[model samples]
Target: MTADTDATDAGAAATDVTEPGATPTATDTTVTPATSAHPGPDAAAPAARSGRRRRVGGGLAVVPLLAFVALAFGIPALAMLDGAFTVKDPVTGASSYGVANVTASVQGAYLTALIGSVKLSAFSAAIGVVCGLLLAQAVVTSRSRVLREAVLTASGVLANFGGVPLAFAFVATLGNSGFLTRRLDLTDKGWSLYSFSGLTLAYLYFLIPLMVLTITPALEGLRTQWREAARNNGATNAQYWRHVALPVLAPSLLGGFVLLFGSAFAAYATAAAMVGSSIPLVTLQIADALAGNVLVGQENVALALSLDMVLVAGLVMAVYLPLQRRSARWLA
Candidate 1:
C-alpha cells in the first residue's frame, strides 16, 4: 500500500511540470524579451528625416528673397564694379579695364570730400550718441506714459523728417535775415548757416531723434534687479554706472554710433540744398560726378566712390553685428 501511494504522488508531480512541444494552459505565463528605454537607430530615423524636410522647406521659401536680392542689389553691384574698373577714353572712344578710377577717387578733391564726410560723420555720431543716450534715459525713467509716448512719437516723426523740407526748415530758422537769426543776432557772432558748423547742427536735429529711437529699447532693457543688487553690494550710483551699467551699455552705444555715422555719411539732399558745393562731401562729389557738373565722363569715378562707400559701410556692419550679438546675449 505504501509503495502504491509513493508512485501515485510522483506521477502527480510529473504531470504538473510543462514539457517541450506541450500546449500551455490558460493560467500559464510566458516570458518576453526586455525592451530598451532609449530610441534606437531605426526609431530616430523618421525624426531625422522630418528635420531635413523642414530645412529643405525653409530653404525653398527663401528662394524668392534670394531672387529679389540678386535683381535689386547684386546686379547693381556688378554693374558698379564693372563701371569702376572700366576706363573710357574721351578722344578715341576706347575702353580699358584698370584701377585708375579707384585711384583717382582717393586723391585731390575726392580725398578732401572723403575726409570732410568722415569728420562730419564722426562729430555728429559722437554728439548724437551722448545726447540721445541722455534723452532716452530720461524718457525711460519718466513716470508719465503720455510723456514717453509723445517723445517717442515725436522722435519717430523727426527722425524720418529729412531731405528738402528739413533743409528748408533749418534755413528759414537760422539763415541770414531769418526770424531766429535776426532776433538772436547770430550772424554778428559769425555763425553762418551754410558752413560746416551749421551743417553739423542740422545733422544733430535728426541724429538726436534717431539716437533716441535706437537707444530707447536698450535703456528700457536695464533691469531693476541689477540696480538693487548693486546697491545691496554697497555700490553708489556713480560706481554702479561706472562698473556695471556703462560696461553693459557699451556695445549698444557703439552700435548707435555706427548707425549715426552711416546715416551722416550717406546723406546728400539736405547738404546739397543747404550748403550746395560750398562744403566738400562725398555724396556731393558723387552727385557732381554723375551729373557731369565737375567734369565730363567721370561717371566711373562716381562708381568707384560708391564702391568706397560700400566698403566703409561693410566695415561698420562688421563691427556693429558683433556688438549687437553681444548686447543681445546680455539683454535677451
Candidate 2:
C-alpha cells in the first residue's frame, strides 16, 4: 500500500510539469502522441519581443530628421515672420502690432522696387543660364580632366565669394580711387563702380558658378545618341536645339533665373553697402524707415513694404512651382 501511494504522487507530479504541448512519454499507456492540442505559453513570446524591437528601431530613426529641420529652418523663419507684425515706436517705450500697418506710400515704393528687382533679377538669371549652359557644355566635352577639375573648383570658390568681403574686393578693384582703376587708368573709360553695370558684374561672379553647378547635371543628361540621331537625320545645331534640347533645358533655365531674381530682390547688405542712398533700392528704402523716426505711424508703412517683399517672393515661388513639376523626372 505504501509503494502504490508513492507511485500515484509521482504520476501526479509528472502531470503538473508536462504542459499541454508535451508529447506522451514512452511509459504512458493512455494518452496518445497524435492527440496533442494546445501551444505552450512560451511559444508566442519571441514573436512579441521581435515586434517590440521593430517599433523601437523605427522610432529611433525619426529623431535626427526632426531635430535637423527644427534647428536649421524652423527658428529663423519664425523670427522674420514675427518682425513683419511688430510695431516699434521711438517716443513710446512699447510698440503696437497687427497686419493693419500697410500704407500707400510704402505700397508705391514697394511696387517701384518690385519692378526694378524683377528686371535686374531677370537679367542676372538670363545671363547666368546662357553663360552657365555654355560653360557646362564646354566643361563636359573637354578631354582634359585636369581642366575640368580646376574649373569646377574655381567655380565653387568664386560662387561662395559674396557679401561683405566681396563688396570690399569690388571697392578695392573698381572704386574711383582703387588699384585696378589706377592700374588701367580707366577713369576716363566712363565706368562707374556705383552704377548698375558694377552691380551686375559683381552679381555674375556668384551667379555663373550657381549656373554651372546647377546645369551640369542637365547637360550630362543629354545622351550622345540624341545628338547623333539628330545629326544622322541632317538636323542643324539650331534645328536640333529648337526641336529637342531647348525643350528639356527650358524648365531648368527658367527655374534658375527665377531663383536668381528672388535673391537679387531682397538683397539688403550688398546693395546697402555698395550704393547706400546714392542708389535707392527698395530694400534700402524699407531699411531706412525702421532706423529713425520710428513713431508717427511710419510703422504701418514699413510693414506694408515688408508685405510687398513677401508678395514678390511669393510670385517667384509661384513660377518655381510649375518649373519643378515640369523638370520632375530629369531634375529629380
- lDDT measured at residue 305 in model 2 versus the true structure, 0 to 100: 70
| Per-candidate clashes, comma-separated | 0, 0
In order, candidate lDDTs are 0.94, 0.75
Candidate 2 minimal-lDDT segment of 10 residues = 292-301
The runs of at least 3 residues in candidate 1 whose Cα sits more than 4 Å from the true structure, single-residue gaps closed, are: 1-30, 40-43
Q: What tens-digit string does per-residue lDDT give for candidate 2 at 130-178?
A: 8988998899999999988998889889877787787788888898988
Tens-digit lDDT track for model 1 on 94-161?
A: 99999999999999999999889989999989999999999999999999999999999999999988
TM-score of 1: 0.88
Residue 277: error of model 2 in Å? 2.3
Q: Indicate the TM-score of model 2.
A: 0.72
